[model samples]
Target: MTAAKKIAASESKARAAEFPAKAGEPAVEVEERSTDGADGTRHVKEFVVLKATWPGRDEADSHKANGAAVANEAIQRGLHPRGEPRFDGAEDHPDGLSLTLTYSVDTVPSSVDHTPGDTTTPRDVLRSEG
Candidate 1:
């Protein structure tokens, strides 16, 4: 299979029947997105958005920064990110955006369902720069 196809296949396997999350569990999605970088290079990535939240309503800068931290930490753990972190427009939460991590194309999620290769505190809402 080609790179894109391989990504799609892996993503489908991860989402087979893990839906309608439990009462308090955050929803997840398998994202296979590509974006062009400032240097003109293209990034092809596939990963899982384990969990997300709108943490900085009315504070655009804070939310984006916080998202960046989470994505960055995920990157350090061998996972890939779509591109530079930014706030995607949302309907339910007008003032904030989602923050999430990612995974390798062939990464099979662990039973624990935590960020891969990470053992540090969560930075999904870290105020300061990492």
Candidate 2:
């Protein structure tokens, strides 16, 4: 079987059942998607998100590795696990420092918009001639 076919088959297996959510979070949802592969075949990709937290950088890295392991396990269990586990970065929240990780069964492109916000203003410069 081609790489695309293998990925599709894996996604199908993962999506065959539901994965229970973590203790405090909502149930995990599996999203079915198809994207054009390099060889022109549309491959189905499954994705889900898992969360982890840490108080410091060392802990965060450890948690991220753990999260990746969990994500891979999800794939083995047919939970539509996507990607090789990604650390979505850490943020400081009222509760504590937290990280949002994404796992996908296949790679996907990402886009970012950089247009300045309406409320943003240019700062004036004080000119000093040489």
Candidate 3:
């Protein structure tokens, strides 16, 4: 099944309880990403962007709210964004600075296909130090 289908199906039981998905509302993927430091030492950050829609609402607005929700959850779990927390002009709680989640709707036939510009950390690069 597609991510949206999976999310919607699971929503019936539980899916971001604080921000439950309304009936017929597809789950928009929210991601927090960071670049490989332009100087190869410090990463460049950007505001969180949504990759899908939230039923009948504005996609951008939905993204802002969902992104903020994700941030709040991360903070509660003692996790932080990949860089300094900054506002992205989103009017969500705390001004939508808690999290700058981004998303890339690049999926394969069976899984999520995150491309170079996708909002996902390159763990392999970080894991290799030699």
Candidate 4:
């Protein structure tokens, strides 16, 4: 499990974290804070990237629609790579038709500056009689 902070606005930010996976549990799960103590809101979103291949042009082409569908949906959901999704590789599977597909996910939160306009009093650094 990993945690990160993403800055959304000058006065607000989002803290996104993932839960550790246990035996037989989902691999990725995101935990987000919508509202912070400073009266700011944060939204945590997740998207999916699909890469696949098959034997011959016909078989490989068959999955184009499905591939596009996922990327499109991810875009509508406010994920990264908005319009152009990345492809793992561009190669023909004319070789015995062996192929592979991989999946990954990530997110981030914010750091500091939660209350930019707030003020604080300074304390003395030295109070010594050693």
Give TM-scores for every candidate, taking all chains together and pairing residue i with residue i.
Answer: 0.26, 0.27, 0.24, 0.25
The deviation in Å at residue 73 for candidate 2 is: 6.0
Q: List model 2 lDDT by residue over 1-130, tens digit each.
A: 9999986676555445342122111122222322211111112222222234233356545544444554444344334332333333443444443433332233221111123131111110011110
Q: Which stretches of candidate 4 lie over 4 Å from their true place?
A: 1-13, 16-53, 56-63, 89-100, 103-130
Q: Would you list the C-alpha lDDT of every candidate in the order shown?
A: 0.35, 0.32, 0.32, 0.26
By lDDT, the better pick of 1 and 2 is 1
Model 4 C-alpha lDDT per residue in residues 13-45, reported as the tens digit of each score: 212223222211111211222211111111222
Runs in model 1 lying further than 4 Å from the true structure: 1-58, 93-130
Q: List the candidates ranked by TM-score, beginning with the highest.
A: 2, 1, 4, 3
Q: Which digits, one per residue and each the tens of the lDDT, describe model 1 over residues 2-119?
A: 9999766765565454531121211222222222111111122222222253343545564555455545544443334443444433333222343332222222112234654432
Question: Which stretches in model 2 have alpha-carbon errors above 4 Å?
Answer: 1-64, 96-130
> On residues 8-125, what C-alpha lDDT tens digit does candidate 3 reach at each position?
6776553344322222222321121223111111122344433232223865445444444433333332223232222233323344434344322111111222232432223322
Model 3 lowest lDDT segment of ten: 104-113
Query: Which 10-residue window in model 4 sums to the lowest lDDT?
Result: 121-130
Candidate that would win on lDDT: 1
Off by over 4 Å in 3: 1-53, 83-130
